[model samples]
Target: MRNTSDISISVVVSCTAQTAALLPWTLKAVMAQTSPSHDIIVVENSAVPELPSMPAREARRLRLLHLPGAARPALRNAGLAAAQGVLVAFCDSGDLWKPSYLAIMREMWRVEPRLLLAYGDAVPLQGDTWGTERGFANAPTGFWDGQRSLGPLLSVFDQPPMPRLLEFQPFLPSGLVAQRGFLERVGGWDTACTLLPGHDFATALRLARHALFGIMQRAMVGVRPEADGPAHAQAVNMGEARILERALARDETLWSQAQVIRAAIVRRRQAALAIAFARGDLAAVQEIAALLPQQERSSPTLLKLGLAALPAPLRRAGSAALFGLGASRTSLRWPGN
Candidate 1:
């Protein structure tokens, strides 16, 4: 392994046909890293041809790999094999980075050689709902448009993490850099996690427990969110469920911990569905209702709210059945009716 001060990070960015709109933004951001030594890896999992950076542009070590799946954890593993850098940073295609991203992360690792992973804040962009980064400093509300509530959980060596990996991941994948040796030591993403909520979070969780890690309180990237994007949520849920299931099967030793995390995530997802229902989001409600197994959904808070509004007898009966909400009745139970 190379020393942190001398480390060159191999940055891996994920892309698909659907995320093409973000290529210019994401790659340019990664390319803009302060430290000139970092290399960029663009993994194209979509059927679309590789992104067009003019032939006139130069990337001495820039490379692109075709992975053929949106879930390119496998491709990431391959990148690990091909990487010449001492560290690896994961970037998502639809995200942008702060100018000092690579430099700051490298400095942090160099300062603390035992640190296994390090990451910071991510600012998200939802279409048509925000402003250009210009004049961001003077905004009274704050420069960040939508700051997630759970960014701080993963910045530690020990703490009771929020239950769901998706809801409060200690480390958001984008902007996170890990020592190449640690990644190889722990083994890469759990391939068995065909789909699960926190590939990044889960990996970090495992690493934090087993290795020394570090955190920097700085803003590092821009994540894009689609306005009321239903399919995205569905994919998110599908991905989480699959990942959690895989986590359980992958490490029998961690099955107990995985169960705790999955239960919390399940409840979180169920609450999301109920919120969509109460807000009369027929599509989101239906999608959330249909995205997983019957025994897998719940909205205890919503159920309690519903029960609170009802006579005790009806509340008891209704609550007992969970309003019979599941894939079969999803279409039948939209909020309006």
Candidate 2:
């Protein structure tokens, strides 16, 4: 195991002009870290680059990179390339970090020298309020036991006896800290996944194939809720589907797990279809439904597809009833349900 006494960390904060206002709070949190990073890099992808004013002490470690109109994946890759620390951490301008976050990560590396990637849990934040739901609330049961520890990282290619890391997305970018070398070895973020919401998940999925992972069970970061509404949800589902498909094509070894990957793709499409149905988006519902195989399409799914052709008023009423019923029957509910 390498000596951890000289660990240096660099934080990458990615933002756009739209989120510039939240940068100050994010930087403030970073500056307050118990174990400060070697540097803080802000990568902004906006037409007009604007930054929050930092005090001299904080400003000394700050560097700004302008990637005009670059997407999140591109901005993050640039940050990875520019980071000078052995360890690199990521946070969005709208997110917050607990003071002990870096300290906990440093200790994790100290204790487990082989750890390639480690992430903490995050609480949901909306403006000034912190939501009770944790970022991993939607993850598979028993996957994260709310304890700080290191463990083997499993991938979708793993068989049933092992918990597949990609079974459900668990890592939040803001809560993640990874070895710089591991990230570079994986070729950084997926630039092709531009405009996709799950680029972080894609990165994590790739890394899972190469190394062991650690988790700090505590909520050490604050994450703003993703934009609500059907369109955003549909986009997320589509992005996840694309990531899974790309994964399958790139690695023939994964073909052994083809059934699992295909099932996950179908689920993402079904989720997109459900979101469209709930929002009474008939066109989207039909579009997503057509992507599903006939065998995978259930009777209720067909009913919803047929209802999409009805008059707007009738369609909306049917949608509302179906949505409410589905919600009520859902066994796996996130916080605030």
Candidate 3:
């Protein structure tokens, strides 16, 4: 590891054969960073390497580290182990970072040496259209909008009457940059979370306990749409709930704060169940429903569940009227423009 004074960053990118088509764009975006990188380590997680050739400029900063036949979380763990810079950032093959991402992170760390990590908003992309992800959509106006003064650093645990945490999405790995020491001290990603799929959340919770967090005002990445279909809905919802459960079990100080977060997640899960019911995905609906509290499985939600059992055409028409197809992904932003 480099000295704490060293500000250079090493970026770990998770890649696989399935994402070959998207890797080039991601790499190009990394090379465009206003703050030049110390290294860009691409961790290939597949039986056979399938990444395309890198351009001369990017190839100079980029190196491929193969962990053939490894899982996604394992690939990230391997890359973290191989990192050599003072600061580390993560990006997935399909996520595109804005040119100013590393530059802003560098500035934030410089302004506050005590800050353990910094993250920015992301404008999500769904197929050909632009979409807003949970973090950006429900972000507390003062923080992300830059009205509140973060001063040197910001920590949810720093003040006495904590800020009313919003029902917003937590920052994902793709948009985060953290101190190398902090990352290592947290024991890197939870390898066991591969089954639960909330490794990022678990890691963030660990970091929040001991260090400060910074929130940048600009959107830093364009999140690629997820490809996993309804078949994995149960796992995804359950994974989020499990992460919160584990956090509450481990930290009593955060109990009150985490309850707000838990409520927000339940709301999102309820919304998700609506989508599943609209599609007549009974199995997914059943699995996800079992994870929520009885009150969350409301009369309206249950009514929708019954409607979904109707004929396909009837269900589609009912769902469109009740849920609005376009509103599903951006429900938090509904009503007007």
Write the candidate numbers in order of decreasing TM-score.
2, 3, 1
Clash pairs, candidate 3, are none
Question: Each candidate: what lDDT?
Answer: 0.57, 0.75, 0.65
> What is the per-residue lDDT of model 3 for residues 63-125, given as tens digits with 9 covering 90 to 100?
788888776667777888888878888888788887878877777667666677776667776
State the lDDT at 51 in candidate 1.
Answer: 62
TM-score of each: 0.65, 0.86, 0.73
Worst 10 residues of 1 by lDDT: 328-337
Residue 73 in model 1: lDDT: 65
Residue-wise C-alpha lDDT for candidate 1, range 98-215, written one tens digit per residue: 7877777776665556667766655556652333432222223321322222233223343322232334343556656788888888887546553553345456556545535455
Residues forming the 10-long window of minimal summed lDDT in candidate 2:
154-163
List model 2 lDDT by residue over 109-223, tens digit each: 8777677877778887889776777766667776654344343321111212212554567667788788999888878877776667565667767766654666666777898
Q: After superposing candidate 2, which stretches have Cα over 4 Å from the reference?
A: 1-5, 47-50, 145-165, 310-323, 326-337
Model 3 RMSD vs true structure: 5.5
Q: Stretches of candidate 1 above 4 Å error?
A: 1-5, 46-51, 54-57, 126-167, 194-204, 226-242, 255-266, 269-273, 276-337
Report the number of the highest-TM-score candidate: 2
